[model samples]
Every structure is written in C-alpha cells, then in structure tokens.
Target: MQTNDAFSFLMAWAAAPFRIGSVTPSSATLSALMTKEVGPDTGPVLELGPGTGPFTRALIEKGVRENDLTLIEADSDFAAMLTKRFPAARIFEMDATGLRHMALYNGPVLGAAISGLPFRLISPRRTRLILEGVFANLRPGASLYQFTLGLRCPIDQTLLDQLDLRATRIGHTLLNFPPATVYRISRIPVTKSYDWRYA
Candidate 1:
C-alpha cells in the first residue's frame, strides 16, 4: 500500500473509527482472498465502501473491466479519489443503504458484489437494509463477499434467515492488520414443493 493511502485511511478512521472499520488499507493477501471467486466472467460488479480502492484494484487485475465496476462510497474524499483513479468506473457518492431505491441498472444485472462496509458496527436494521438493497440488484446465484475482523460472521443468523440468505466462510488472512475473514453471502436456493397426490 502507498504511504499516502495509509495516511488517508488513518485520517478517515480517526474521524469515525466505527464507520471506517480499519485504520489502514487492506493488505494484498486479504484483497486477493476477498476477490478470489470473482473474475471477468462475473459480469458487472458492485463494490460498497471502496476506500482507497485496494479491492477495486484487485478486481481489475482479476480481469473485470473498469466500466463494469459500480462503486458506492459515502465518504466525499474517497469518492473523489476513486473517480480520478478509476475514471471508467461508475462511482456513486451515496449511502449504500439507499441502493434499494436507486436504479443502478435496468434490473438485477450485477453478477457479484464485494463489500468493505463495517457491518459489525452497524445496527441489525440498517444491516438488513444494506443487504436487501445489495441483493435487490444482484442476479440469482450471485453473492456478496464481505470481510470482517470478528471471529464469526458479522451478520447475525436471524437476519440471514429473515432474508432467506446464507453465509459461508470462504477464506481468512492473518496478513491483514488485525486479521480478517471473508464470507460469501448468497440467497438460499429454493426447492420446488413435492406433490404426493400427483405421484
């Protein structure tokens, strides 16, 4: 990571530790783990809270075209920086929870989403809104990759059940500051109901 990036991250963290989540940018190891399952084939990608664009860089390296990226960042400075760094990407300087109301695309066209949001600090209700908004724009079988510093999944089980979603631990990296674990959050597959009378 660049020194300026680290300084900017530290400043952001100092302003609102809970909102920023970490005092430094994610390490390359963690970035790789978070994006390991996504590639060019993933189609248009969505990224939430892309501070300093570490994971965003990894996505491009994984062959996801710059134009295929839609970044949602609340911080003004970070949003401005991202625009300059990724001119081809669609950078939206707005709260991610508002995604459900916004028409980011014509429909559920996003194939995957990677999140750097601080879920552990957010309230369950707000978390639900964020998840609902994100999943609203994701195609079936698509997933949202989220990383947390907590030992367990940051999203509670009740909320997952409420949304008919599931979380699976994909990987973790100690190389990252304070360490972090990546979870793949996807909608549970729906099975057709059986009809004994027909049989």
Candidate 2:
C-alpha cells in the first residue's frame, strides 16, 4: 500500500468514521480473499467503495483486466485517487445507494461485485436498495463479495430474504488489524406460487 493511501484513508475516516468504516485500508490478506472468486473470465466486475484500491489491486492480480472493472466510490477524494491510479477503469464518483437512478452500465452481465462499503453502518432500507441495484445488473449466479469486521454477516437475514439471496462465509483472516471475514452472496431464484383465492 502506498503511504498516501493510508493517509487518505485516515483522513476519510476522521471525517466520518461510520461511513469510512475502517481506520486503515484493508490488509492484503483480506483483499485477496475478497477477490478470490473473480477473474478475467468471470466477466466485468463492480467494486463498491474501493477507497485505496487494495481489493482492486488484488482483482487485477487475479487476472481481471483493468478496463473490465467498474469502481463506484462516494467520496470524491478517493474517487479522484482511484481514477489516477487506474486509468483504464470506469470510475464513478457517486453513492452506491443511488445506483437505481443510474443508467444500466455497459458491459457483460457483471461477474461479481467486491464491496468495501460499510454495510454494517448503513441502514437496512438503504442497504436493500444498494443490493437491489447490484442484483439488477449481475448475471444469474454472479456473486457479491463483502468483508466485515463483525463475526456475523454484515447484511441481516431479513434483507437477504427480501432479496432472495444467501450468504456463504468464505474465510476469516486474522492477519487484518481487527480481523475480518469474507462472505460470498448469491441470489436464490424465487418460484412463483399460485393464489387459491382467484380460483
């Protein structure tokens, strides 16, 4: 990680601890685990809140092309830094929760979404919207990868049910500052049920 990266992350955290989530950028071990499921063949990938590009670097190392990645960062400063660092990537300086209002991005059905967002700090309603937008753009079976400092999944069961999604714990890394676990989220197909009242 670059010295500037840490400094920038610290500044962002100092401004809004809850929004920034972590005081420091994610560790390399955690970054690797979060991007383990994606690659060039996996199609285009979306990265939410890629503050200093730790996971972004890992994804590229995993064989994903820089041009095939879309980075959505709410913070203008981090977004500007990411744009400079990754010239080929599509960087959008917009809120992840506002994805619903954005045009459908041009790409193959997104292979996966690697998030650095602080889902634990976001409200359930907004979290649902962010996820709904993610699912709307992803291909069937595409996974959403997220790392959390908490022992439990950052996303609650109620939201998962509403989205018809399931979370699988990928692995836990004690190497990180506060330790973190990665979860792979996949949408579960919902079967339509017949209503007897109509008959």
Candidate 3:
C-alpha cells in the first residue's frame, strides 16, 4: 500500500472508526488471502468497503479484469479515490445494506463477493441484510470472503443456516495490524435433484 493510502485510511478511521473498521490499511498478506479464491477465470466480482484499495490491488494482481470488478464504498472520499485508482472498474458510493438497489449490480451475477466491511460492529439484522443482498446477486456456488479481527466468524450461524450457506475458515494472517482471519461463505452444494419419474 502507498503512503497516501495509509494516510487516507487513518484519517477515515479517525473520523469514524466504526464505519472505517481498521485504524490501518490491511496488510499485504491479509489482502492476498482475502482474494485467494478469486482470479481472472472467476468471472465478475463484487467488493464491499474498499477503503484504500488494498484488496482491489490484490485482485488485479490475481488476474481479475478491472472492468469486471464492482466496488461499493460508503465513504465518499474512499469511493472517489477508488474511482480514480480503478477507472475501468465500476465504483459506487453507497452502503452495503443498499446494494440491492444499485442497478449496475443487479444485472450481473457475481462470481465472488469480497468484503472489507466491519461485521463485528454492525448489528446482526444489518449484517443479515447485507449478506442477503450480496447472495441475492451472486451466482450459485459463488463465494463471499470476509476478513474479521475477531477469533470466530463475524456472521451468525443461524443466519447461515437460514440462507442454506456454509462457512469455511480459509486463511489467517498475524501480520495485519490487529491480526485478521478470512472466511469463505458459499451455498451448500446440492447432493441430488428430486424427480417424479417413479411416481
């Protein structure tokens, strides 16, 4: 990450720590881990709370085309910076909870959804709403990767069951400021399809 990116993240956190999440930008290791499952062949991707574009940069390095990426940043300053930094990608200045309303996002079925949002700080209801919005626009088997400072998964288990989704601990990095772990959430695979041929 660049010095300006770090400075912008710090300033944004200083203003609203809850919204900005981390006091420092994510470490390179964490960024790489968060986007490990995504690649050029992974199809279009969606990113939430791309504060300073750490993960965004990592995604590009992983072979994801800039034009195929959609970034949602609630903070206007960060969103503007991301727009300039990733001119080819579509950037939206809107809350994650309101993602369902974005016309650009509603059209495409995402291959992956990477989140830098602070789920620990958000209420369970809001978290459910955001996840619902993301999954609604994602293709079957597409994964949502999220990094959290907490030890356990940030999202509730009940919500996972309700959505028929499953979570896997993909990676953890002690190199980040406070240490972070990445979780991959995806719909449970269907074992069989029912038919009435015998009946």
Candidate 4:
C-alpha cells in the first residue's frame, strides 16, 4: 500500500472506525486472493466499500476493464479519490444497501462482486439487505467475494439459509494486518420438483 493511501485509511478509520473497519488499506496479498477468480471474461464487476482502491487495482491486474468496474463507496473522500484514480470506472457515493432500490446495470449482468464492507460491524438485518441487493444484480452462478477478520464467515448462518445462499472459505492470508479470510458467497441452485405420477 502507498503511504498516502495508508494515511487516508487511517484518517477514515479514525473518523468512523466501524465504517472504515481497518486502520490501513488492504494488503496486496489479500487483494489478490479476493480478485483471483475474476477477470475480463467475468464481465462487469461490482465492488463495495473499495476504500483507496486496493482491490480495484487487483481487479485491473486480473484483466478486468476499468470501465467494467462499478464501485460503491459511502465515504465521500474515498469516492472522490476513486473517481480521480479510475476515471473510466463508475463510482457511486452511496451506501451499498441502496443497491436494492437502484439498478446498476441493464439487468443481472455482473459476473462477480468484491466486498470490503465490514459485515462484522453491520447489523444482521442490514447484512441480509446488502446481500440481497448484491445477489439481485449478479448473474446466475456468479459470486460475491468477501473478506472478514472473524474466524468464521461473518454472515450469520440463519441469514444465509434464509437467503438460500452459501459461503465457502476460498483462502486466507497471514500477510494482511490482523489477517483475513476470504469467502465466496453464491446462491444455491434451485432444483425442479417432479410429480411422482409423471415420473
């Protein structure tokens, strides 16, 4: 991470520790792990809370086009910085929960999403709303990659079941400050029911 980015993150965290979640920008190692599964072929990507654009840079390195990225950052300063840093990308200065009410694309065309939001700090109700919004914009078989400092998945199991979603631990990196684990959250495929008589 650059010195300026770290300073900016520190300031943001100081202002709102729960919202910023971390004292510094995400490490390169964690960013790589979060974006490894996505690339140009993944089509449009959505990123939540991309503070300082660490994962955004990683997504670019993985071959995702700048214009294909849509970033949702509630922090005004970070959103402004992202606009200047990635002029081709779309940056929204709004809370991610608003995604449920907004249409980011023509339809569910986004192939993937990367989230840096602090699920651990957010209430379960809001977490469910956020997940619902994200999945509503994702294409079939697409996933939302999230990293958390918690030992287990930050999303509650009850909420996951209610949403018909599942989370799998993709990987973890000790290099990041406080260390973090990445989870791939995807919707469970619905199976068609057959009539016993028809069978």
Count clashing residue pairs per candidate.
0, 0, 0, 0
> Local error of candidate 1 at 112, Å?
0.4
Which runs of model 4 end up more than 4 angstroms from their true locations?
none
Q: How does candidate 2 score on lDDT?
A: 0.90
User: Could you tell me the lDDT of residue 63 within candidate 1?
Assistant: 97
Candidate 2 weakest ten by summed lDDT: 99-108
Each model's lDDT comes to 0.96, 0.90, 0.89, 0.95
Instruction: Please list all clashing residue pairs in model 2, or write none if there are none.
Output: none
For each candidate, give its TM-score against the true structure. 0.99, 0.93, 0.93, 0.98
For model 2, how does the per-residue alpha-carbon lDDT over 108-181 read when each residue is reduced to its tens digit? 38889999999999999999999988888888889899999977999999889878899999999999978999
In the range 5-117, model 1's lDDT, one tens digit per residue, is: 99999999999898998999999999999999999899999999999999999999999999999999999999999999999999999988899798789999999999999
Between candidates 2 and 4, the one scoring higher on TM-score is: 4
- Candidate 3 least-lDDT 10 residues: 99-108
Superior by lDDT: candidate 2 or candidate 3: 2
Task: Write the residue-wise lDDT of candidate 3 on 1-199 in tens digits.
Answer: 6788889899999999989888899999999999988998998999999898999999999999999999999999999898888999998898899965554554547899999999989998898889888988898879999999967998889888987888899988998989999999898887886788976
Which stretch of 10 consecutive residues in model 1 shows the poorest summed lDDT? 95-104
Quick one: how many clashes does candidate 1 have? 0
